[model samples]
Target: QSSNVPKLGTCITCHGRDGIGTSPVFPNLAGQKSLYMVQQLELFRSGARKSEMMNVVAKSLTDAEIEALAAYYEGLDPGK
Candidate 1:
């Protein structure tokens, strides 16, 4: 799959290296529903959800990338 956005550990900056959010403000992406994740990303991209960081991040992501990211996070065990 192809992507227009730069792939450079962009998700790790805030969501943490393991997709478990370090802060309560950031939702734990680990083990989250893929559909829910995709929806939230789309919402951020479309301005439905107002977050400066997420809006910037989601705006650059392609649909396939979003799915891959969501799947990757969902596979992680948050309890670790």
Candidate 2:
């Protein structure tokens, strides 16, 4: 893991440190395409895609932070 990824972030409450969702309500983020993640995050931040939790989480993120998160999650191994 690099500086792009936080050792512990708000995402960890639902999506675990390894990108696995802790609950059924949260989709697993591991191995997701960075492009897809960035798109979804942008939508969520803009309130175009509705998710109470995601919107709040994304709202505080800058574009660079969003990209960093997408890269971090995209780099994770889903098989692990």
Candidate 3:
């Protein structure tokens, strides 16, 4: 239930603490629609999205971890 730690350690590096992404190539996760994030994460994990890096990372996530991460990003404020 508590996924904050994993999100910080695993996501913050490229996604940024605010989830706005470190650069233009990385999409902003903050305030993104939850369903969208979930779907995308699932695709990434399943190797359907076709990103080498994402595939590797996403494949390691458990379902709970994926949901928790999506929820965390969905709750963030990109404008902040």
Could you estimate the TM-score for every candidate? 0.84, 0.91, 0.88
RMSD to true structure for each model, in Å: 3.7, 1.7, 2.1
Q: Candidate 2 regions off by >4 Å?
A: 2-8
* lDDT minimum window of 10 residues, candidate 2: 1-10
Ordered list by TM-score, greatest first: 2, 3, 1
Give lDDT tens digits, candidate 2, residues 1-80. Answer: 64546433788789887889998988999999999999999999999999988898889988888888888889889999
lDDT of 1 by residue, 1-80 (tens): 21332342788778876777878887777778878988998998898999999999999888888887777777777888
CA lDDT of each candidate?
A: 0.78, 0.87, 0.82
Best candidate per TM-score, number? 2
For the record, the alpha-carbon RMSD of candidate 1 to the native fold, in angstroms, is 3.7
TM-score of 2: 0.91
lDDT of 2 at 69: 89
- For all candidates, the clash counts are 0, 0, 0
Is candidate 1 or 3 superior in TM-score? 3
